[model samples]
Target: MIGQQAIRDWLFINGKIEKAVHILSSLHSPDDKVFVNRKEKDGSTSKVPCPLALKDYNSNMNFVDNFDRLKKDNQCDRKSHKWYMRLFFHFIDCCVVNSFIIYEELDTDGKKLTNKNFRREVYTGLLSRKLVDVQSPSILKKRTKSTTEISNHKPHVSKHLRLTESKHQPTQISSRRCAMCSTKKKPQRTK
Candidate 1:
């Protein structure tokens, strides 16, 4: 079993928790520390002292719960199916939550908006900023007619051609061909 001193030492290493505990202790008043009668499992009500940290912890948890709920309601990170996209989605969710909190904090006199509504408004505002007037769709239809017309196009030269062009026999073996390339056949379409 761990001793009380060990637990205290562990708490000391956690700077944020230590700072919060110190602040709570400073603000603590005798009247503020009220004991509420809690019913026990054995059928007895006992006056239990509620710590300041419990309230702070619960409030912080509530904020996180709200942030998660808002993220779930208005998800915008499904643009790609790749695994790496999850990181981007999480980042976007964090940004939305932070922006919503900042908006709420700034507007002291305005009616408080729910997390869902706040997220929707933020998304709509972003979409509004990106909206542009398109002159014509015909501009995007232009394409190079042939491979020769493309400036960046390079013709694929076979390994045999390279060996013939070079006077010295290649000391190194040509790189192993890809499995698909060795087949020398196009994939058949299902439909």
Candidate 2:
């Protein structure tokens, strides 16, 4: 599980790195070029232009190697605790939402923006969306009342009672009524 989590983390990091590089590339002017100039004492000069910085280009390989290491470790199958899985899902959702926000902020028309302001706008938009999945009012009221009742009791609610009262009730055989005849019946013996 640790290995899997590490792999996932690396993938997410790589995605962020890609986005960062894209943002940096887009920020550059169309005609910008890195030039190596050779000048003699007589002031005659020649310039060799490079499309991209060699050092900057080489650093991406390091990120690729990190990703490969994570993949080779093969740790994703490890059984994780429920809470860890929940947190992982939450992190993934946040990343996806943020990625969308980044794209939108970068692609918007005629707007001069800083990264901090862009992130703030995205977060505000996310907050304004009615995305939370709360239960209906009556269901919430019932849950609140039940929780309060449970809390008021000195000891915790009994395991059996809790199970019975859970949102997903356990399947139970209630008196085993015959489907054909309207009568409760025991298992019949085969002759």
Candidate 3:
């Protein structure tokens, strides 16, 4: 208590800091302190005082730390020269890890599959599925031709009259491939 007024609830670490830090915690009120390393103005490390909550959070972020460990060590994402490929593989790895966590929670049986085993099982299941012909990647068109046919009105001398009168309609021969059919990325398809 300072005279008649008393500060409550929030911890402030402002002394000898380039930037002031304020932390409010329901668990820890102000006046809680633990010895922590701090860099002096002379650029030397020192064990200065720190809040118990901040120290605890640094030492005990178990789930996030565990995920970083798993991704770095166990994930099968490969290094690629293509920036997009690297991002894609990393995204796939994150999905696998997240799904494994969900599977662990949803499982009622006492038996639990290890992360490696879970990944392997998923890989095999994906490979075993038969892809449909229409969903296959990279279907080459037999020939490229403009499918639009103009109306049977002959062009008169006036350019404006021709544009206003003429109507071009798409002639349906075979079902044209979907927009993504010819691209060499993921899936190709045709009817």
Candidate 4:
């Protein structure tokens, strides 16, 4: 059985959890209120709270509950609980910065989820925000032919004649162009 410290170390080493405690602690607001303490010109400290409240630690709990639901439904890997926790923290960070949740933040693979309409709907609902764009990594095609060779599959044949069984055999002719003048020339016919 892996210890908590070992799991923590793995997560940290892999960059799966970026400052876990700091992120988790930031989400724990006393109340659903944005409190701002300011110093007045009269040298008196005044506290102003925003009526438009942020989601408290309860919201964090709900996120975890939803994650558990996903795990139960077999939609995500139950073994990677550490990854889920890190993802939750990232989601919280995105919410705090954007003042709204993002669907891709909760998605295991953003590209794969964005491709399916039904999954995208569920993702949006879970995140409580619309996604502007979810860009996937571009795939490149492999080059089969080399710039200097005619056929990539076959072995290169020499331009000169070959001696086989004490008899001179002419090499296969290649239709090539002149390097300097850019002129096409046929192979020389041997008698």
The most accurate candidate by lDDT is 3
Off by over 4 Å in 1: 1-8, 11-45, 49-56, 77-83, 108-117, 128-191
Alpha-carbon TM-score of each model against the true structure: 0.39, 0.22, 0.42, 0.16
Q: Name the candidate, 2 or 4, with the larger lDDT value.
A: 2
lDDT of 4 by residue, 1-191 (tens): 11122232122111112222212233223333465565788999987552111224324568777555444332322334688776775554434333223444665665533223444344445651212232232411344454653545542222331123212333444734323323225544334
lDDT rank, highest first? 3, 1, 2, 4
Between the candidate structures 1 and 3, which one is better when assessed by TM-score?
Answer: 3
lDDT (Cα, tens digit) per residue for candidate 2, span 1-191: 00111232121112222233322233233344466565757999977553343224544678567444533332223355788886675564455445644565578676755444544454556552322232455865665333322345343333664554444443435754334333336544334
lDDT tens digits, residue span 39-96, model 3: 7889999896666766776578788988877676677777789999899999988888
lDDT (Cα atoms) of all candidates against the true structure: 0.55, 0.44, 0.61, 0.37
Clashing pairs in 3: 136-188, 137-188
Task: Identify the candidate with maximal TM-score.
Answer: 3
* Regions more than 4 Å wrong, model 4: 1-55, 75-103, 106-191
Q: Is candidate 3 or candidate 4 better by lDDT?
A: 3
Off by over 4 Å in 2: 1-57, 61-108, 128-191
- Residue 69 accuracy (lDDT) in model 1: 80
Per-residue lDDT of model 1, residues 1-191, tens digit only: 11111232132111232233322233333234345566888999998665444445545778789778867777667767787898888898889878877888898777888887787667656652312222233543564353544556443333564445432342433654444444547733333
Q: Model 4 lDDT vs. the true structure?
A: 0.37
Off by over 4 Å in 3: 1-48, 130-191
